[model samples]
Target chain A: MMEFLQQRLTDLELFGWDEYINYWFFLAMMALFAFELIVMAFKKAVTWNLIGDSITNFITLFAYRFIGGLIYILFYLTAFFWVYENFSITQLPLTWMSLLGCILLADVIYYWEHRFMHVCGLGWATHTVHHSSPHFNISVAYRFGPLDGFFPFFFHLPLIMLGFHPFMVFLAEALVQLYQTALHTQMVKKLPRPIEYIMNTPSHHRVHHATNSKYIDKNYAGIFIIWDRMFGTFAEEDEKVKFGVYPRINSVNPFTVFFHGFTKLGKQLWEAPSWSYRFQLLIRPPIWAWEQEQKRKREAAAAEAKASP
Target chain B: MNFFVSALSTILLGLVVGFALSLQKAEPPTEFEKYSSANMDFATMSEVGYAMAAFGRESTADYFELKDYQEYVQLAQNDHAKALSASDSPQVAASEAQASKAEAPTMQLAQVEHPAKPKAKPSLKDWPKSVIGIQRSTELINVEKVWQEFASNSALSDQLDSYTVSVFAIYSDFNSDYSRATISIGYDKPSMKGEQQLIPKGKIETLLKPSNYGNNALLNAWQDIDYSKAVKAVVERRDYTQNSELTSLFVIYQ
Candidate 1:
């Protein structure tokens, strides 16, 4: 039985089943989203803003796929195969057990990567786009920033070094993303207690998307919520969630939605007092950068008044 | 309008950078090559040693054939001793003697070298006489017609039996000047193992010349192939050694 399963997995890996699964899941999500729109229409909640927002979401998705496709073909494949062939500690065979372990590990890695996106200035500059949508739906799950596809290389390449096949790692990453995509909805409030405790549900993800002070930077899981719980980043759904980033973008234009975070970050870096401050604005937390910018402005105004007197 | 301009400019810059990086054609380092490169730093040396040790411990299957950790450690020690012996000089020998007296057991362990083992080559008498070869360019070739022609010739396909065959296509970077072909024949009956032979580029060119395939238009069509395209052909025959159960020929040309 085990051998049969292993062979099946090997065949699946050979035939690029991961890509097929993702494509099928995408179609299913689109169908579900169509149903969601119908329900919204019945409830008299479907508005032009919501329609425009969803369209922008798909536009960002296409832009991301374009850049991502190039990077994957040109950079990721070569680098991954090179490292796996040369530096891997051992060549792990494709078994059901190994695949399961890889997916679990990839989930843990995603949790940290997701948390990094929330806390670090540069990560947030790319990641804030996903959370910028005022409405939460399946379409919002498709929303992506310009550099969203680039950052995973830093976080997941270690799996290849540790002997997991690059294809297996790719599949695991895709599965994690697909699982999270299913979480981006207002339709399902919560799952059973045990499931909500173990897995990342829509409730947990809604909390993650919320800009409320209590929910900011919380529940950064891709599939399993256990990492967030263990890392003290977990937050339970309590108050009504207010979606979108702080100081909202307030535009549904695809370009605006996609590039707003980076534009805001760029302006801050430009207005920064020194080269070191600009560097800090990149690596430091966004909130910390904002505080420093405010301090710098106050000091500049004080200096200007004294010079005028 | 600003967004479109910026996006296009960024993509153009990315394409330029990606193309430049791809042009370098960096090859992955071999095991000993990694160790040699790591010799520059103490931390890297330790890291490489640990990684190799870990690999030797974990991979003991058919592909790697690393028997055990002790054998792996002994191999490393032997390699170190050989290097020391090759570079020995009078002054170095004296320093080595002094260090040996100071650290006898460690010195003794480092100085022990094992004799290289002679590998037993399989006798060709047990192998099949029939050989089939195919050439492919960028354009697809009809492999079935070539196989039928070879089989009907009787000179190369006298053995009558069943078979299993696998074909693989290998393509190198367009910028790379090197072109070679690899042929491997394996047996599925558990008694015989596969062996690989690499045919050189010059030999391949000679075999595929137009004069060699006179009156055979199918093979002649591939004679005008460009060498700069990095085309590779793989010929595989499986289960042929079974004598009664199998006779196989497989070829991939790209």
Candidate 2:
């Protein structure tokens, strides 16, 4: 069965079927999203803000794709090829087994990379754009930040060094991404217990996007929810889930949504008292940085009052 | 300011302690270390012998004579004696050296004549009309005969004058027997600038004939390779000059 599947994949690749799969799948999803809008309109849920937000999501997607393409062509591919050619311990043959292993490992790496984006201040500065949307829908999946494409290089480069071909790693990454894209919806409430436990369903991903205190920094899985369970980041959908980021940017304007994270970070850095504190703001968690900023403001106010007295 | 000074002082103190610790005497070599050192010496000697043979010079037997062997033994004994003397055991060192000499049998050195000059590099003019180079691991297979067979087709041979025809067969793994392979043929206009500047004539997805793998060791290893695999092989173009005749070709596998 494995050999048969491998041969089928090879045939599809030979016929260039895999190249056009993404475009076709995207068109199908867009159709589904349009149907969803019509359904929401019937239910009196469609608003101008929702429409603007979806448009902004697409704009961010285009920007991400443009920047991501430049980075991939100029840096990512070059680095991946160099590391694979020079440092790879062994070249794994193209087979069903190896491809499966690459996908599994790539998914695990995605979990950690996703977690990093939520925890690290710099990472949150970029990732916050995706989570900034108040509404969860298919269009929300398309929302991306400027450096979203760039950070994956750090996580996936090791796959190339581990002997999986760069192309194989790329395919694995795309599969993981595509799987997650389908989960950015509220239509599917839950699934069978086995699948819900094993896979990253819409319910699990909804919790991931939730900004509620209980759901903050939870469900960082890509294709498998097992990673979150194993890593102690897993949370079940028990309560009402709130979407969007904390201290929201409050704008559907594409430029505002795209640059807000970096602008906010820059403001914090400028407000920081010292170079050491500024550096700490970059590496520390977003919550810690926020707390530190509040502390700094209090200290500054107290010092000003004392000087005046 | 206080923090900076303390940090600097701590770093300086750490450096001094590290340097002092590094200057301390090393422990005696372990049995594994001695074995590894002896193995390395043997490997070095073997490499020298291989290098000489590869360059068409004398073999290892002709290179190391009885006199040279005796001289090496004498040098080793002298070094051992110096070490023993440093330990204030000169009498024991002398007795050991005497015993070593007694164990050595008297042998005559064989007179051998050395080559007067090094061999010259092969002229590019001697290069074949079509060159097929296969690189796999440390082995490089240059099959002029295979190239001749390929050039037998008038259509392919015609491109030799204006375009550099490159046939690249890429394998998924080093062990090609069980791996997948993909073959591509690229035609590039010969130019001096670089591969990037070359005007691509065309490219064709092709397959190598089974007969091509008959004699070549590298290709034979790839006999069972699956040609259905998807791979993109890089094409490398190189220029060869002999007198006024300039022959340009693409080195498919480097």
Top-TM-score candidate index: 1
Which portions of model 1 miss their true places by more than 4 Å? A1-8, A11-15, A300-309, B1-254
Model 2 chain B weakest 10-residue run by lDDT: B109-118
> Per-residue lDDT for A11-112 in model 2, tens only?
112112223445566888898798788889999999999999999999999999999989988989679878978997565554445566677778878987
Give me candidate 1's TM-score against the actual structure. Answer: 0.56
Error of 1 at B163 (Å): 16
**Which residue pairs clash in candidate 1?**
B162-B246
Residue-wise C-alpha lDDT for candidate 1, range B15-111, written one tens digit per residue: 4433332333223422221213212343433333344334431321211222222343444355456547766423333343334333312101112
Model 1, position A283: C-alpha lDDT score: 83
Docking class of 1: incorrect
Instruction: Determine the iRMS, in angstroms, of model 2.
Output: 23.9
- Shift in Å, residue B149, candidate 1: 11
In model 1 chain A, where is the ten-residue run with the lowest total lDDT? A7-16
What stretches of model 2 exceed 4 Å from their correct place? A5-18, A300-309, B1-254
Residues B60-149 of candidate 2 have per-residue lDDT tens digits of 223333334344356446646664767643444345445545443322121111111112322323322222333232212333433443
